[model samples]
Target: MDIQHVCILGAGTLGTRIAFQSALSGFQVKVYDIHEKSFELSKKMIEKIAKSLVSSQIYTAEDIQLALNRLSYTLNDQEAVNQADIISESVTEDIEIKRKVWTRMGEIAPEKTIFTTNTSYLLPSSLASFTGRPEKFCAFHFHDVFYSRVVDIMPHPGTNMELIPILQDFGRRLNQVPVYVRKENHGYIFNAMLLSFLGAAGKLLVNQVATIEDIDLSWKVNFHVPMGPFAILDQIGLDTAWHVTHQLPDANSQAFAALLKTYIDTGKLGEKTGEGFYKYTSK
Candidate 1:
């Protein structure tokens, strides 16, 4: 199906990026969030990304303006999904919350609206039945749309096979390299590998094997990559990292989760809040 109107169910970091890119790709985009502050942050984040895109010559000023014009924000559930051809959900990573959101969307969204979750580690199958349209639901996970640029199209067992190509085309339109996950797998592909890498860094810190700086330096210096694991954690908000980490039934994960909670308790939720393991001048 042609995806013309895109509805993003949350105005968090990833949702904001997806909505902006959809608008950039000439889709009418609406970002929905219960929190008014989320809209403010989402708009600010989009503007920041737009500035970077323009300065880097990746997007012309006119292009950015047109994209901005195409994008909108809303809090009304019915209005958000009424005209949406596709709904990309990036709500809180909690299962109960996701189930509730999908249930509500299933009740309100048009029958033609394709349901997708931008969940980093959750399986689509787990939430498919909740949507009341298993065949129409799938996982369309994106990672740092402009930078990472890989979108994972993972369909649950009940998902219509026809959706793969449609989502693949849509991913390309949003300037993402589409990767298909043949089966349901938690964390998909890249994130499965990433979890291990990040977990190792966390273990080292928890065990006092090395300082966060030394551990990160080891990875960066060895791989000659720009950001280390801790620095990467900063990019992925500490709260998000904690949420995923805390769910793992492992001692190391639990320990890391505890460490992350300390940062979260202080409201230092990584780059968005200007402090995590590292400090950033820009939000």
Candidate 2:
């Protein structure tokens, strides 16, 4: 299918980035969120990313302006998907919430519209049936659309094999490296390794083996990389990390989830909230 209109079903950090990049790729994009405030936040985040792209000379000022012109925000469900050739959902990481959203989308979206979820840890099979069109649904997970540009195309058992090439083409159009997940897996490829690395850092902190700074320093120094696990967690958002961690039925995961809960309770979700494992200055 030739995709021209893209619908993003969230206005959070990742959703905003996906929508921005889709627009930059010359698609007419609409971003939908329940909360009106999320639109303002998404816009600010897009502006910040646009500035970086400009500074890096990845895109010109006029290019950014034209991309912004193609992007839009809305609250109405029907309006969001009315003309969408494909929908990329990045809603909250909760199962129930996602099921409800998919069910509604199945009802309102055009019959020709393709469904894709940007869920971090959830399997496409778990949510595919809820869409009322399992063959048309798949997981097209993206990690940091610009910097980390790999997009995972994972299909459930019932998904049509034809979608692979279509989605692969779409991912490339959005300037991403498309990776095919042969089977249903929790964290796909990179995230599976990432979860283990981050879990180790959390274990050290919960066990009092080292300070967050020290643990992060250990990884950075050893790997000769800039950001460590804790710093990376902050970028991923503490709430999101907790959501995935708390679901694991392991003692170490439970301990790490509890640590994350304290930060969340105080409304310090991460860099988006200006704090997490470390404080960040607002751009």
Candidate 3:
């Protein structure tokens, strides 16, 4: 089905970028969050970012303004779902959180309204079961700063293939590279590789194997990686990195568990908390 009203549930980094880009693709967007302050901050951030896109000629002035106009921010739950023809849930990485969202969306929205989750780990099957509507449910996973380019569309075995072409068209309309995954898998494609690096980096910082700046510059000089792992960890918030690592059951589980528990217990939650692996004084 052709989606018009695109509702994004979450005011986080990925959610905000998705809403901004969706609106730019000509869909009326409603961005919702439970936290009032977070929602407001994200709204203003998007406004500034939209203007930047226009200045960069990545989007026209009219396109950017129209996109901004299409976006509405709210804390109301049922109202946001009611207004959406397509729901993109970017809330948290927790499966339980997404399950609740999916179940709630199904109860609030009409059957035809599409359901998509931005989760990188959780599979579409289990997530769709929350709504009893796995068929119309799918995963449209976006890379960080979602508006830049790459996105992956994951549909379970039960996903409605009738709309696959339309979904691809929608991704193209938003100027994204959309790849479809027919089977359910955790971490999809991008995050599978990303989480590996995330753990490795955190280990370094925690062990004092290298200072943050030394780690960052090493990447820039040697691998020419876009950003160093420590810098990224700070930007992503140590708590978030900790959570992802803690959730995974892998070879790194022991180290991740130790690192994460320390952060959580000590309240060193990265940039948002003014300290994590690094100290911050920003208020």
Candidate 4:
């Protein structure tokens, strides 16, 4: 199918970024969130990011204006999915919520619309079944676009193999490096590795092996990377990190979950909220 109009469901952190990238790539973008207020917030976020891109010289004023012009925000489900060639779902990582959204999408979306999920850890196989279009479903996992530009495309057992190249080309159009995953792996390839690293880092903190500050410094000095595991947790949001930790079946995982949950409960939700493992007073 010749994809043109892209509908992005959910306007949270990742959703807005995906919408921006799609619009920048010259796709007609439609954004939908369950709550009208949430969708409004996403619009503000998109505007903010567009200005930042201009200031950073990554995009020009005309470029930002053109991209914004291609984007539309809507609350009507049928209106959002109607005539859309690609529907990218970027809701929270809750399985039940994902299933519910997919069920609705199946009911409202056109038959030829390609369905993709932006879930980090959940398997797309079960979710695809809920969509009533398993063969047309796949996981198009993306990292934070500011730093990471790689997207993992993992298909379920029922997914059509012919759709892989088309999705890959779509990824390239959005200026992302698409990595195709052959097997059905929860978290795909990159995230699986990242989660393991995060688990170990959480263990070190919980076990009192090293301080968070020192551990972060050690990794930075050695690997020459911009951020450490704790910093990454901050970027991922404490609530999100807690959700990931809560799913693990280990004592260390439980401890990590508790630690993150404490911060979340206290209203410190990472960079988005100003504080998490560390405080971010400024950008």
Looking at model 2, the pairs that clash are none
Clash number for candidate 1: 0
For model 3, give the RMSD to the true fold. Answer: 2.7
Candidate numbers sorted by TM-score from highest down: 2, 1, 4, 3
Task: State which candidate has the highest TM-score.
Answer: 2
**Relative to the true structure, how large is the alpha-carbon lDDT of every model?**
0.94, 0.96, 0.77, 0.89
Off by over 4 Å in 4: none
Which runs in model 2 stand beyond 4 Å of their true positions?
none
- TM-scores of the candidates in the order shown: 0.98, 0.99, 0.88, 0.95
lDDT of 3 by residue, 86-128 (tens): 8888887777787787788888887668888887677888788
Give the clash total for candidate 2.
0
lDDT, candidate 4, at 211 = 98
lDDT of 1 at 52: 98
The positional error of residue 80 in candidate 1, measured at the CA in angstroms, is 0.9
Alpha-carbon error at 45 in model 2, in Å? 0.5
**Clash pairs, model 3 backbone:** none
For model 4, state the Cα shift of residue 175 in Å: 0.7
Local distance difference test, candidate 1: 0.94
Encode model 2's per-residue lDDT on 139-245: one tens digit a residue. 99999999999999999999999999999999999999999999999999999999999998999999999999999999999999999999999999999999899
What candidate 3 gets wrong by more than 4 Å, as runs, is 145-148, 260-283
The parts of candidate 1 lying over 4 Å away from their true place are: none
lDDT, candidate 4, 63-165, per-residue tens: 9889989999888999999989999998877888889999999998999899999999888887999888889999998898655999999999899988899
